[model samples]
Target: MRAIVLTEPQAVALVNDWPDPEPGPGDVVVAIRAVGLCGSDLSVYDGDRAVPSLPWVMGHEGGGEIVATGPGVVDRHVGQRVVIEPNYCCFDCVACRNGRTSACDRRRIVGMNDPGLLAERVAVPARFTWPVPATVSDGALGCTEPLAVARTAVRRSGVAPGDRCLVVGAGSQGLFTCQTLLAAGAQVSVTEPHEGRLELAEQLGAKRVETAEVEPFPLVFDTAGVPAAWDTSLRAVAGGGTVVMIGMSRSPVSVSTRELVQRQVTIVGSLIYDHPTDFSATAAAVADGSVTPEQVLQAGSHPENAAAAFAKAREAPGKSWIDLSSWREESA
Candidate 1:
């Protein structure tokens, strides 16, 4: 099996003889079809975010077919097309017991804490694999994980029908958040510096698109996660409004306590999606045509082009995916 291994900061190599994953009890080995390159993966590549260990396989969002199932895996079987939910949690944790698995004390993300799907195959718990509809393409199915993150942010924002909401950033997650808000009947506005991304926001149903300026909105989502964007988000929200922070920023930004107190502003930080429910809802949305994957997943790259693919994904307004199926064709 071949895998893309991050050997050091700003370094990646294609290892042709990487050991294949073997399924454990209650797990299955999936033949990865496509994997989505994420911002967090880029962070790891740039050495901005620290991982649990080094020399890790790097990818989390992916879709594939089950190749083999281990004992205790009853429902899922060989040849079932599925999407990966990358979060693994300890069921006995306090947060898990309370149905907040995303906040579990021992939660581990696939690419960060465990071996990821950037290889030809990966071993994952059967419970974390959801069968995707045949109507969805492998490229589209690879985007379900990010869509679930967007869904969680929207839910945390509590943006209802007819509410005015502003989404900061027109990146992949920002665009997904905009679409989700629109599906909930909220009047959505978007702020983005890139003209291509701003155009994408309009195509995704945003009522208004601005490079920097925006009128005060009742609900604001800060998906950019930069200090300047955070400052702008605070000023863009209306008094007594809510600001949902979905993007992760590496540096700390100073906030004025007096302004928050005077205006009765509420700031909430949203992490990744909640376990089964959020992942299931995102897949259902993709299947039902509520969320269009073609709008987000722009193109596919081969494993040999991992470095160039990451660069392209960073500059792209939408998402870019690695086409693992091409490896078989080339190797054959």
Candidate 2:
């Protein structure tokens, strides 16, 4: 088996001869097909995000075919194409009891705490796998994880019918946020400096707004973690409207207390999905053409070219996929 091992910050390698993993009780082994590179992968690569340990397998958004199942599993999901849900939580936690499992007292994200999907095969808890519809493209299945995050953000922000929503960014997550809002019947607008991302946002059903045109919208969604993005979002949301923060900022920024008090603006923060259901819903949305993952996926890279993939993602315009099957040619 081959896996991209992140040994340290800004360092990764395609390691060969890694022993193949076998499924445990209540687990499933997936022969990974396609994986999407996300900001979290970059964060992990850059050592910005917190992880329980290192030697990390740095991808979570992926889909694969089930090659085997554990002893206790009886779902008959073997040979099924599925997407891996990366979140695992302690169900007894207060947050999980309240349906806020993303904030669970004990949470282990797949790539961060355990082995992830950026490899030739991944063995994960059977509960974490969701059936990928035959109608959905493989690349689209690879995108459901992020789409779930976007869906969670929309669900948290209380975006409603006829509301004017402002998404302050046009990257992968931001674009999906726009799409989710638009699908919910909100009048969606987006702010992005990148021409390519902006164009994609428009194609995904968002009105593009230049910095000069910033105004108060009914609801503001900030997926860009930069201070300027939130500052602009604060200025763009109407009085008493909510501004939801989805991006992971490295540090805290000062807010305009007077403006927040005067306008009664609500600032909310969203985290990751905690269970398989979120992933399932997102998968269904993609399968139904609601969230077009195909449009957002730019290209793929082989596991051996993981470093090249990172460089490309940093230089290129949009999301990139990790093609784990790239090693098969060598074997052949």
Candidate 3:
């Protein structure tokens, strides 16, 4: 099997002789078809995001076909098309028991804690695999993970039909958030410093696209983790409204407690998706054309050129994907 290994910070290597994955009980081996390079991948590559370990295979947003199943895996079988959920939770945790799997006491992100989908094959727990409709392309299916995150953010915002909402940033996750809000019948507005990304946001159903300055919205989502965007989001939400923080930011910034108290603002930090619900909902949205994946994924690179793929992802306004099947031709 061929895998792209993040050998060290700012280094990526494509290794052709990586051992193939062997599934455990209740697991299945998936032949990865398409994998999207994420902003987190860039963070890991640049040493901005600390991982549990290094030299890790670097991808979690992917979809593929099931090639084999391990013992006790009955419901999923060979030849099934599926998207990887990526978040592995400890089912015994109190949060998991309460059906809040995203908040499980011990959760392992696939690429960060375990081997990721940036390879020819990956072994994932059957429970973490969701069957995707054939109507969706492999590249589109690869986007389900991020779309799930977007859906979770929108759900946490409590935005209702015809409500005014603002999303800060026009990156892949931000654009997906905008579309999710639009699907929920919210009047969406987006803020992006980049002109091209701002236009892309409008195409993704944002009714208003502005350059970082905007009126107060009843609901606001901060998908850009920069301090300025955070400050803008905090100030952009109307009094008594809600703001959801979906982007990860390591730097600390000061906030006005008095403002929050006086205005009665609701602030929430949304993590990854809720296992089956958010993942399934995102897949359904993709299949139904409610959230167009192509709008966010603008290009694809062969996994053999994994480094180039990462570079494209870093520079491109949209998401960059890796075609994992390309290794077969190279090996042949």
* Top of the candidates by lDDT: 1
Cα lDDT, all candidates: 0.86, 0.81, 0.83
For model 1, where is the 10-residue window of minimal lDDT?
Answer: 323-332
lDDT, residue 113, candidate 1: 76
lDDT tens per residue, model 2, 1-332:
78887888888888876679899999898888788888878887788876677677778888878888989999847778888888888788898898778888788777877777777888888888888676777777678888899898898888789998889988888877887888889999899888988998888788888878888888899998888887788889899889899986777788778978999989899887656567678877777776676777787776667888876675455668887655533443
Which stretches of candidate 3 lie above 4 Å from their native place? 52-54, 209-213, 328-332
Off by over 4 Å in 2: 50-54, 274-276, 326-332
Superposition error at 328 for model 3 (Å): 6.4
Worst 10 contiguous positions by lDDT, candidate 3: 323-332
Please tell me which model should have the higher TM-score, number 1 or number 3. 1
> Per-residue lDDT of 8-124 in model 1, one digit per residue for the tens?
888888998889888999999888888998888888888887777767899899978888999999999888888999999888989998999989989878888788889988999
Ranking by lDDT: 1, 3, 2
lDDT by residue (tens digit), candidate 3, 1-332: 67888988878898878888899999998888888878887888787777777678888999888889999998998888888899998989888988889998799887776677888888999998888776778788678889899999888777799999989988888988988888889999988887777778888779665545578888999998888888888889889988899887778978889989999999899988776788887877777777777777776787667887786676578777887656533533
